[model samples]
Target: MQTRALRTGGFDLLVSGLLAACLLTLCGCTSDRAIAKKEKATHVVPVKTVAVETTQVQRSTLQPATVHAFYRAEIRAKASGFVKNLQADIGDYVEAGAKLAEIDVPEMLMQRQVIDKRIERLIAEEQRGQAGVRLAEARVRSAQALLAEASSQMAGAEASLAASQAEFDRTEDLVERGSLQNRMLDESRMKRDSEAARRDAMASSIESAKAEVAVAEAQVVAAQAASDAAQAETEIERSQRQEMDALLDYATLRAPFAGVVTQRNLEPGDLVRQSNEVGRGQPLFVISQVDRVRVRIAVPEAEAALVNPGDEVTLTFPSFSAAQPIVAAVTRTSGSLDPSTRTMLVEVELDNQDGKLLPGMFGQASIHLDSKVAAQTLPSRAIRFDEEGNGYVYVVGEDETIARADITTGLDDGNSIEVLSGIEPGQRVVGPHLKRFSDGQKVAVLPN
Candidate 1:
């Protein structure tokens, strides 16, 4: 009976083992099916995407800048003189050629007076010479008249002698033929001789008159030459006076261009000498044009290659307003870098027509070294961080799956960030709603 009970218990144990094995197998199959169904339920999600492409970026470099006047000139005394009065004071705005100061040059005034007096004397001498020329002309006319009268007298005397000679010839022929009286012949002969002597005397008078006329004409020529010399002297004197006047005009200092007076060196009664070289002597005034100013900057040697003319630049005046920046363009640049400073000089022109910006104002300039550069970039928001804090972005894979791609970030220009590595241009990246995507998640890339 105990042996029969042991067999029955053993059979029951066998059946329990079979049931436990079958239950364990069924549970394992059910768990695997549930996991497979859950994974299969993850459908292709509709997500926005953008192509990874190159974009233009602007890069800037900051440097110190100095503000200077567009044009600066030292108003100096051109003539040795004293400052008689200051027409313009420091900070006064003056136009080009406007008088800045009046100088009192006693010697200059005296020299002008002397020139004036000399001119008057020369003019008077010219007038006297003209009168002398007229007097000489009158003498020539008188001599000509006297010579004509002498010629007339000689002609009359010759005619009378010819008549008397004819009478004498007729009377002598009558006397020889004894038909006329001898006394008549003698009277005709005497009359003919008297007429001949008068003709000779009249001829001599004509020669004398001609000589006198020639002398008078020579005197007239001399007088005319003297007159011309006097006139030329007058012209010379006038030219000299004009020169002196020009020098005298220089005594009044004038603005070389429209600008503000930055400095004043002379007061009333200050003796100022002529200043030719700058920084050598005190100037009466210093004028600088503030309507337009030059913003000068020194670019480092490393960045000099990026600077060029016509490139836009920004300037900020720390002494004036730091927030408000003045926008201008690079007007010029020194082609060669400075050996000592190892920097290249750049200049920007700024208009200050409102007279707000002053010369010598301190400022800073930002040069857009690379104004616009095309490079591989992405929107800042598109970048993501992985669990390990690595920079990455979600990309659309070839199989229409979300791929976590690692990328190296470069310059961030507020609008976009540069991708230096691990991503190629023209590749599609998940756009907005990137959080909806997970690793290996199937997705439908929407049109951008």
Candidate 2:
């Protein structure tokens, strides 16, 4: 009976051992299946994605700038003299062409008086010369009349001499033919000789008249020359007076344009020198037009080409911080870069009718460098850089597989990056946790 009992107990024990071993194997299989399931789930990463779409992209730059007056000028003395009647000082508004001050040019004034006297005396001389010319012309007419009378007298003398000769010839012929008395013939010859003497005396008188006419003509010429000389002298004196008048006009300083005086360096009774002289002296005044202002900016070379006239700009002045930023369009550009600083000059004009904006003020300028109207873009996080600095994105295909796509990018606005190439609209790209995915890896899209 003892042997039978031992055999049953051993079988029970073996059965218990077999059950424990089966339970252990079952637990081990369950643990292995759980781990495998977790590994499988990890391979199919759940990623957030975004669709590539078109949007507006902009890029801008900020640069320091300065404010200046629209028009400024330095007023200086044009004539050397003592300052007198100084009518303008600093902070005075003046009109264009208004007299600002008068220069006390005592010597110049005295010289002007002398010039006036000289001009008056020359006028009298010119009148005297005119009278002399009239006298000379009258003498010429008298000389001409005398010449005519002398010619008439000469003709009459010739005719009478001819008549006397004819009578003598007739008497001598009659005497030779013994038809007349000798005494009559002799008397006729004597009469002819007397007529010849009279003719000679008349000729001498005519020559004397011609000589008088010539002398009168010579005197007339001399008088006319003297008259012309007097007239020339008068004209020269008048020209000198005119030059003096112009110099006198320069003695008074006038405003070149309508503006406010921003500086004053001279006072009444101060000696002023000509501004154009060697070693130019200090300016007497500074004029500026404050109804309008200009903001000047120096854009760097790299972005100079992007700036253009008429582009919108925003300006902020440090002195007027509480004031709103001023919006204006670019007024002008230098078109070329400065060689020394590699910068381009740009300016914007604004109306300052209120006189709030002052010259030499500091400010900031925000300039739009580039803009895109319908650019393909994605979230900035969706783009990544390679070791070579090239940008890329993980694009999800229709099969839900991620394919690394290399891309070219343009303007970035912090939130979105413009895709210049390699990606099209409607394409889905991985947005975040990009490091977990690789090329050709499967992924599950999560709602974003």
The best candidate in terms of TM-score: 2
Q: Which residue pairs clash in candidate 2?
A: none
Instruction: Residues 170-270, candidate 2: write the lDDT tens digits.
Output: 98899999999999988888888887887787778777777777777777777768777877887887788788777778778877888888888888999
Q: What is the C-alpha lDDT of each candidate?
A: 0.87, 0.84
Candidate 1 residue-wise lDDT, 1-448, digit = tens: 9999999999999999999999999999999999998887665678777777788877777899998999999877779877787789898999999998898988988988998998899889889999999999999999999999999999999999999989888899999999988888889899999999999999999999999999999989999999999989988988988998999999989999999999998888888888778778666789999999888899999889989998888788877673577788899999989999999999998888988888888878888876577878888778887788678888888888878888988765656778899888888888756354668888887776
The TM-score of candidate 2 is 0.67
For model 1, the stretches where C-alpha displacement exceeds 4 angstroms are 1-53, 57-65, 168-178, 276-279, 296-316, 319-324, 328-349, 362-373, 377-423, 426-448
Among residues 3 or more apart in sequence or in different chains, the pairs in candidate 1 whose N, CA or C atoms overlap within 3 Å are none
Measured against the true structure, the TM-scores of the candidates, in listed sequence, are 0.63, 0.67
Model 2 spans > 4 angstroms off: 1-53, 57-65, 172-176, 182-221, 277-279, 299-316, 319-337, 347-349, 364-372, 377-448
